[model samples]
Every structure is written in structure tokens, then in C-alpha cells.
Target: MNKSFPAIFALALFLSVLLFNYAAAQSTVQERIKQVENNLTENLQTNDAGPMNLQKRMEHYKVNGLSIAVIKDYKIDWVKAYGVADAASKIPVTDQTLFQAASISKSLNAVGVMKLFKSKHLDLFADINTYLSSWKFPYDSLSKGKKINTANLLSHTAGLSVHGFGGYEPGTPLPSVIQILNGTKPANSGAVRSVFEPGIRQQYSGGGTTITQLMVTDISKERYEKYMSDQVLKPMGMLNSTFAQSPAGLKRGLLATGYDVGGKEVKGKYHIYPEQAPAGLWTNPADLARYIIETQLAYEGRSAKVLDQETTKLRLTPYMNAEAALGVFIEDYNGLKYFGHGGANEGFRSGYYGSLAGGNGLVIMVNSDNGEIIQELINSIATVYDFKGLNKTEKIKLANVSEKDLDSYLGDYQLTPKLVLTITREGKQVYAQATGQSRIEAFAETSSKFFFKVIHANMEFVKDDQGKVTKMIFNQGGRIEAKKL
Candidate 1:
């Protein structure tokens, strides 16, 4: 054989090996995606087998649309979308459809704030009033001689008022950031004032985040949205995200419409959140995966697109609380720590998690008020990928109670002026429907205690000396006592 013939045969063999490896990698990705699609689990499993497939769970939760992105090796392995963007229009959800990030905005806001710290534009431990130009925080006796700092704002340790906001509806005139701070005319929330001594303990304050929003503008001499877009989100390669209260530039049908738990469209499509730092960013799962990937890379000192390795470490470190770090909470699963944040806006629920090591992360967004399915999906993904301790499946057992006992607990329990949890019975099974939420069955675990299968909530029926039901102790994230009304 000629010398040229030997060279040509070697080149052909190299090309064949490359092609075979690429095909094998693609096969692995598709297999993982398929496993996640069919493995959706419930937070509370019952004797009855409900829907487990991805599409069936979406319908079972009455969710109109949802998107997911899984990250591996500091890169997005897959991004998937399911259901409709708008149920009324029958538009299918695509990977590009943006969902409201809600309180998840706080996580990114913390990044922006930390970037300011990195540049020495302002001090995170300095009194926020140092950079605030338009409004001043009213230092009342509630502060107890302590000063509120930007660090406190990010860590929810400032002890400020207003746990969260009820966003304005479409056609309603929006409030300026100053108006929101002062709770002036056109602002629906109360003024952001001190409720207790600063730095004493952790108390959630969306109002405190709004303070940092103004400080950002004051220090940078730029709009909060623009500064974040240019310095934080864009540099991190999150191009499909925005802090616009009204996302005006989006192409038609790119923004997913929000839906209630009952599958009804939210009037005006969605509420307008002018509180950009706390709950205003609109983004999709794929874009959020980039933020997580950047964080993971920077944590390992591998990448520093916006924040250098040192500053990224500061942002992830817990400030005062064990879990409530600067912007995101550090969740310890087994012994591995994962940073995460959850968001809930009107007719929208979303969540994201990034492991401290292994370069592993996942983002999930949904355009429905019912958040029960979101946790269930996380459990399923965590189980498949071995994200230890995130699997929160509690195989619940049902207890049979006498019909008379079940009937005694039937009535409306007034939780708030606007919210009432109504307990009803259909034959022997009891059900509960909270105001503006879908009705869920409340299984009797005991004669007085009942729990829900779709969400991790417990309702313990209380009785008086006469043995008549008087009130209900609703326990989920916290304990709330509601008198039977």
C-alpha cells in the first residue's frame, strides 16, 4: 500500500470515534430527561395512585404551564417546557416563555448589591441612609438605637415592616419607589418602618429590599433596572431576564400569563410589581440556570463574569442566620449545603436550587397559584439525581373518623379578613378550600388532626368544654389559629 493510503485510513478512524462519543452523550441526556418526566412525586402520597407523568401532574395541580432547567458540570444539560402559556388562548408553553420570578428576584438583587460591595460603590455594613437620596428610613424607637445597614436588608435582619406586597393590577396607576417607601397615596402597602431592634434576629422584610433598590440608584446614579441589567444579569449571561415592572419590550406571546389554582386566568394577566428588588424580575428557567451556573463556577473560582471569587463567597456565606444568607437561603441537605430561593406572586409560583459542590442545580417555574406541584417536582428530581435530603416525601396514612366527628369540623375558619379556609365533607371524606386556592382533600390522620395530600399542611380541629368544634390550628410553614366562623 502507498504511504498516502495509510494516512487517510488513520484520519477516518479518528472521525468515527468522535462521532460515536457524541451520540452516546446525547443518549445519556435524553434518558435523564425522560426519567424526570415520568418520576414526578407527591409531598404526601396516598393509597390512591395519582398522576405521575409530567403532563398529568400539571393537569392534576390545575397548573396551566411550567418550565424546568437542569444544570450539570457547571452547564445547563437540558431545558424543557410543558403545558400552555395561556389556557384561554391555548398557546403551548415554550422554553422562551418568561414567568414572573417573584421573590426569587431577591436572590438576584443580592447579587447586584454584592457587586456594589465589590466595587466599593457603597458599604454593605454602612447605614443605608448614607446612599439613600430620595427617602429616609424613619428611625423610630422600634429600632432601639441601632442602625439598619445594606447587609441587614439582604439578610432580612433589619426588622422592618411589610412582610411582602400585594402588587397593583393592570390599568391601576403604579407608585414610585419613594411613594412605596413612604406608603403615600397610590401605594397599597404600609410605610417601611422599624418593627424591632436591627440585627437582633431575622425577620423577613420585603420593604427592606426596596430600600436597597433606591440605594442602588442613588449610588450608581442609574435606574435600578438598568444598572442591574447592565452590571449583574447581562454580565452573568442572563439575557432573557428583566426587572421591568411592565415588560414592554417582550415580543407578543413570550410572556406567560398567570393562572389561579382553579385554572382561571388572572385578571389583567398578572399583577405589576414595582418593588423590583423584592419581587419584580421576570425570567425563565433556562435564563435562571445561567445565574446558577455562574454562581457555581464562581464559587469554585473558575469564573468571575460579574462577581469575583471573593465577593461571590461573601454573597453565599450566611450573614447572621444559619440558613438565611445574604440573598438566598443555604439549605443543608444531609451535610451538603445548597443555596436556594422560592417565590410566590399573584397566580405565579417558582423556585430554584444550586448545590454548593458538584456543579449541580435545577430551576423550576410555574404560572399558577398552586405551588403544591413545584415541591413535588423537586422531590422527584432530587431522588433521580441523588440530591440528598431534598426528597421530602412523607407517605401519609389516613385515619377513619366517625361521620359525626367529621361533620363537627365542617365550617369556614377565618384566617384573615380576606382569607377564609372552608372545611367541607363529601360523604365520608373531608375537603378544604381556602380563599382563592383550589379545594384539596384533608385526610383524617386522627379524629381531631387532618392533613392534606397535595401540600404539607395540617389542620387540627379544636373543641370547647361542650365538645363542639370551635377553631382550627392551621400549621404549614407556621402555626396560625383561625376561629370557626
Candidate 2:
């Protein structure tokens, strides 16, 4: 009985240690989640607005639903969903709820195209017309006789027209790819023609991605969605994702209803994207996190489930010194390198970012047109996780200005040939709207200077010697002087 007593004591000690470690790990996860949910920020600053909660931010932004997935150590650390998927039905969003991936679809399309390149089924440098069978690109002198290649198309250096598409509402007549490319009747956008010489610069073109969609169908003799699912998504374990133009079967109920910035539900819930390669993906963040992890692992030469290390490197490499690498954009935050893409459909906005070296990243999807909340949530997660080179916030304070002074700054300013900033006054508030963008309220930092609460942008009203407003210097990404017109 003495020998048995020792064994029993050891078993009890082992169980105690296991339970203690488990409880500690659970507590750590809860703390991380709590920090992320409460620390939302735009510029990581403390102002009158103060620290924001995720639910409050969602309400403030008029976002109806949101899904997020966080990646740590090359795996999905956690995924969370918030708000109602359908306000009318009060259907709550869940981890499985699907949102339009929008332009993130291009990232996966690039992977599938690279798979073909790896199999020797296609060549990256070959003229795109070589693989295209159903239709041919109408090359004009704008192309400078430079034939569009797979690399150009993937990297957005093909000089193609139609930056994006406004998808058809449910039950609306959808245009065929050929019709869309030709800019014919019933097509919502212009032709996908060469706007400049290929390989000169990077211009985002979802139309170019659509051409690849057709190419995949033409060359593989399979539907674009099927090809992508079988070749890239399934192998990477993104089982919940699909490029189907319309949600069907079990996906119907899982789809989140789209909402406008005003919190109004879009008619028919959401638009149908026939251009599957650019804006047609219906997926959740957990599935996208899988793709990010696979990309990280493959780049590290640890996995070749879909793309091998050499091919993944080629896909991530920028073409012609452009900021874009294949379908993803390469950006440096502080000093950390990241490759990711942002997507915006008519009523859906989504974005994802993954580290170039580490397996750390995040994916955010919202069912509202307003994208202001996406970055704020990312900032919160970065802060809580102590991610390198992210969540750098600055303190800012608002200044008091007279209503009469605000009225004087109201006018139209031309920043460029195509860009204009229109400042309007409503009662005591001032709002600024750029051409082709929604109106955003501007709060005064000084009588002549104003800043936006939702975005990292500022405006300074410049006056002439006579104290008359002449021009305004717009500062957001950079400074640009716009003459008051």
C-alpha cells in the first residue's frame, strides 16, 4: 500500500498542473479578446471621442454586421462575429456567416493562375491571348505594341480600363463577360481596353481580373468557380469559400445582408457579382485566414498544398517595381512588410493583411459600404497582440471655431483634372465630399484647419492677403493643394 500511495500522489500532482495550465491559457485568451474589443482606434489617438468598443464602433459606423479572424503563429488564433446579419429578421452573424470578399477574390485567383504556371499549363510571360480562347483583347496604340501578359494582368500593370464593377442587384440582368469587356449595352462599366502602355505603371483593374476568369474557363474547360474551388480553395482547406456569382443551397442563409452607410438595407440583400475573379467571392474571415496561413507556410517552404515555395515567391514579387505583387498589394507599416488586399462592392467592404515573414495577420469583413470601422478594429487587434509596426496612435484635440467662420470655408476646390472637393455647410456642421466618395464630417482643429474623425485626413483653408479663401491644402496620405474654384 505504501508503493501504491506514491503512484496515487504523482497522478494527483500531474492533474493539478494540467488544470492550472489550462485555466491560465483560457484566462490569457479572454484578456486578449477583451483588450481587442475595447481598444478600437483610427489613428491610435486619445481625443474627446476616447477609446471605442467594437459594438459601439459598429453602431457608430452604421455597420450591420462584421466578421473578423486573427492569425498568430501561422494559424487562426480566433474568429469572432458581431451584429445582426439581417436587421429585419434579427439574424445574428456567426463565424460561418459569409460576406462578399470583393477584390480579395483576385488574391485567390492569382494563386490558381500560379498553379497553372507551376504545372506548365501556362506561362507567366506569354501573351494573355495565348491562353484566352473565347475572346481576344483589343490592343490599340495605347498599348505601345506591348502585349499583355499573365504577370501584367496579375500585377495590375496591364493598363486596362474599368477599375471596378458595380455588381447587379439580385434579380437584375447580369451582363456576360464579353458584353462587360466590350462596354456594350446593359454593361454598367466601360470597356476593358488599354489605357496606356503595358508594364509602365500599376493601375487597379478588376476588368483585367475578369479576363483571367474567362481565361481559366477557356483553358481549363471548367467554370471559374469550380476551377478555383478544386485547385486552390479546397486544397488550402478554405472549405467555406466559393466564387459563385450568387449564393445558393446552404450558402443562402449564411450570406450576410448588405447595408449602406446610412444603415439602410440594400435592396435584395446584396448584389450578384458575375465577375467572379474580382468581386464574386462569398466567404467568411476564417476561410480567408486559412489562405493567409497557407501562403505563409508555403512561402516558408513548409507546405506545397496549393502553391510551392518558388511559385509563392513569384506571386508575391512586385512587377516592374510597382507596389502591387500579383493580385495582392505590398505595403510596409512602420518597418514590417505585409501583403494584402482590400475589397469594396456596392454594399460590402472587406480587407486582409498578412506578414511577409511571420505567420501573423488579420482579416476583416463588413456588410456595410462604410469601411471606416475595418481599420479601427485592426488597430485594436494589433495593439492587443503587440504586433510590430502597427497601432501607432497620436493624441489630437479639436479646436473651437465660430459657425460664421465655418461658413466662409464652404466652396468647391479642384485638386486635379478629375478630383474635386466640395465643402458644404448644414446648420452648424461642415461636411466634405471628394469626387466619387461619400461625404464625411470635418471637425475643426483651428479656425482654418479641420480633421476627419473616420479617416486619417486633414484640411487647411488657405487665405489670400485680402483674407479671402483662395485654396485648400488637402492632407491625408500626402499633401495636395487644391485651388478653390
Candidate 3:
């Protein structure tokens, strides 16, 4: 044979070996995925809340209705609904019961935008200003020439403020979409202005997604909700989901009433998010699971209908310096990497998380303001699956302390620039209330640590340089420091 022919043959042989190794690795992963599915099926059937009384705890924590969906091996193997959808009607919450998915809608909107990316009509990192028609972002002197892209908006790195949209409650005149963007009346939930230069640090801004929605309307010349229905919801078969922004839809009676920590159902107030892309869509756990499965398929290169493999990778990749990726928070929990988003609306809370490595994932939603309870419950269940990177360890262990000492701990503490904690004593017992929240009972877990029986969090008093108790840092959903004010 010629010398060139011999070299080509050697190169082909090396390529064969590499392909063989890759195939073997993929086979091993599939086998592990099957095993995880088996374990989840068994555990869910026999799930009696062993290490912690999860089901009972949900009820005690005033969770009116809850649902869970698990995706394993590219299939939605489990979907379970718990408790009553309507407490008064005694209607059981079934898989079909439509719930306000809240901010979970943002993830779906992000997917819709990615579809535009596949058409080569949208650039994720392009200047958002290029798509604007009605008005441009009022960039400050520092950020006048800076650009905000789809990637920045998705990952919350657009340097915008006002973590998210606050839905319209009853008796409030609904703000127009422009009014919301302008921080006008009825849309005061988030600041209507940018905080820092575009592509700076991570700051949760549903306003960014609102801008995304505006851009979609401007480019497609169609309503945001209609575009989403045609492009994302219909393809995904989310039949029960709706983009309706009226209380009449809610009053039609399939919707679960939002509840507070005390189990008081909230009515006359529903979210009319001008930030439609961020918090507008309402869906069920089943539909949300399907959306998540699509993400998994995209990652594996098995599907490219909505987004190309390269664009999908770019969206999932972190944009800001934070762990939050485009439209979802990405973190290494336990030892496996997970990608999902958490949502909280008026009286409802939901979280969707799954391993990026294709092991398993979970979706949990509760019809209560106390979504932290669901977070704790899911984190506990994840631990059973031996998820390696979960940093959630905050728990409630109540202790009976002398009533007199309660007075000493009673004081106002500041958790953040926005969060304030007020401690009040009644006899030997101490009750705590955060700003804008009703008073709650704080049971002593230890002499130093106390737990909020309603929400899944604990407060521990910290001493200052004088050792006279200057601060009380609360550890619950995450670390939050509260200095005595």
C-alpha cells in the first residue's frame, strides 16, 4: 500500500476506538438511569415519610394542595397529586388540576425565545435595544452604550433590580404593561429602572423578562401569550396551561385558592404579571415536567426542534458570575449538577430541579405561601436518593424553654436591606414576625436556636463584640443574617 493509505488506515482505527469507548460510557449511564428510576418508583409507592413526616408535615405547615412529578431516563415516570384542590369544595387535587405555576412560566418563556434562536432571527447576546420599538431601556450615564442580551436576561445578569413581578391582588387597578415597565401605579412590585450596567452581576429581575416579552411582541408582531401558545405550549402539549390574565378564569373554579402560613385562603387577588415572560403562564406539574424533559433531550443532542445543541448549551450555561443559568438556577447539589427554577407567587410556591447528568429529577408545588416547607420536604427526599451536593440541612427541632427568658430575646432584627424580623414575647413564649408577614410562633429548638413552626426556618441569636447579643442570624431556606436593630 502507499504511505498515505497506511496513515489514513491508522487514523480510522483510532477513530473506531474512540467511538467504541463513547458508546460504552453511554451504555453505562443508561444503566444507572434505569436503576435510579427503579429506586424512585419503589420509594414513592412506599413513601410514608420515614426520616421526616413529610406528608403530615405538609398539612401541619398548612400546605393546602401539593403535586410532584419525577422525570427519569427521559420519561415522566411518576406524577402524584396530594390533598384537596379546594378546601371548601372538598375537591381532590388531581393531575389535571391547573395551578398557578408562577415564575415557573419564565423557564418556558426562555425556551420559546430559544426557538427564535434556532431560526437565526434572534441573537442571545445581541443588544436588546435593537429589538425595542415603543421605548428603549433608560440606561443611566454609566450604562448608556451597554447592551443587554437574551442570555443576560435569562440568567438575571442584566443588572436590573426588583427580583420579580408582584401579581395584582383584588381591588387594585391593574397596571398596563408599559405602566409596569415605567414603575407606574399598580406595578410597584419591582423597580422600573435598571440598577447597574448590562452584563454586570446577578440580580433577579423579572423586569428583564418583561422586556423580553416586549421584544418578542415587537419582532413577531403578535401578542406575547399567543406567540407562546403557538411556539411553546402547543408543541409541548400543555393543554391545561393558560395565559389568561383575568380573575374570571380563576373564579371559574378549577383554580386552588392561595393560602397564607395560618391556612387562611387568599381570594380577590391574582397575579396579572405585565412581565408575562417571567411570571404569566399558569401550568400544571405534568406540563412543567414535559418542558424539563425537553431540556434534557436538548442536552443529549437527541432533540433539536426548539433549539440547536449549541444554543441550548449557551442558555444552560451561567451568564452572570452567579450559579443562576439562563431562566434557571444551576448548582452542584450533593455531587450531581442540577438545573431548575423556583417560583413564588401570592399564596403559591413551586420548585423544579433535576440532575443535569441524567439521573433523576423532581417537581414540587404547594398552594400556600410557605413554599419553604416544600423546599425542605423535597430536599429531604433528595437526600434519600443520595444526592451529593444539596446544601439544605436547616431543620426544626422544638424545645420547651422557660417563658421568662423569652423577653431577653424579644427585639427587632434586620436581615437585609429589605427584610426585617420583629420578635415579640408572650409570657415565656416568643413569637416572631418578618416584615409584611403575620406573627408566627417560634419554638425553641435549643437554648440558642429557635424554629418557625409555620415556615421551614430557624433563627439563632449571635453575640457581638460586647457579647450582649447584637444580632440573630436566621437559617432556613438559605443563609440570612439578621442584626439586632
The prediction achieving the highest TM-score against the true structure is 1
TM-score of 2: 0.89
RMSD of each: 3.1, 3.5, 10.8
Model 2 CA lDDT for position 80: 89
Overall lDDT per candidate, in order of appearance = 0.90, 0.89, 0.73
In model 3, pairs of residues that clash are: 333-389, 333-390, 334-388, 334-389, 334-390, 335-388, 335-389, 399-444, 403-428
Candidate 1 accuracy as TM-score = 0.90
- Model 3 misplaced stretches (Cα beyond 4 Å): 1-50, 142-144, 170-172, 247-252, 394-485
Best by lDDT, which number? 1
lDDT of 2 by residue, 65-154 (tens): 999999988978889899988999999999999999999999999999999899998999999999988899989899989999999999
Instruction: Give candidate 2 regions above 4 Å deviation.
Output: 1-16, 44-49, 397-440, 454-459, 462-485
Clashes of 2: 1
Instruction: Estimate TM-scores for all models.
Output: 0.90, 0.89, 0.76
Give lDDT tens digits, candidate 1, residues 1-485. 69799788999998999999999999998998888888888877766655388888888879999999988878899999999898878888999999999999999999999998999988989988888888788898888889999999999999999989989999999999999999997999999989899998999999999999999888889988899999989998889899987888778888899988888989999999999999999999999999999998898899999888899888998899788889999998668999999999998999999998998889999999999888888988887788787878777667779988988999999988899999988898889999998788888888899887767689999999999999999999999999999
| N/CA/C clash count, model 3 | 9
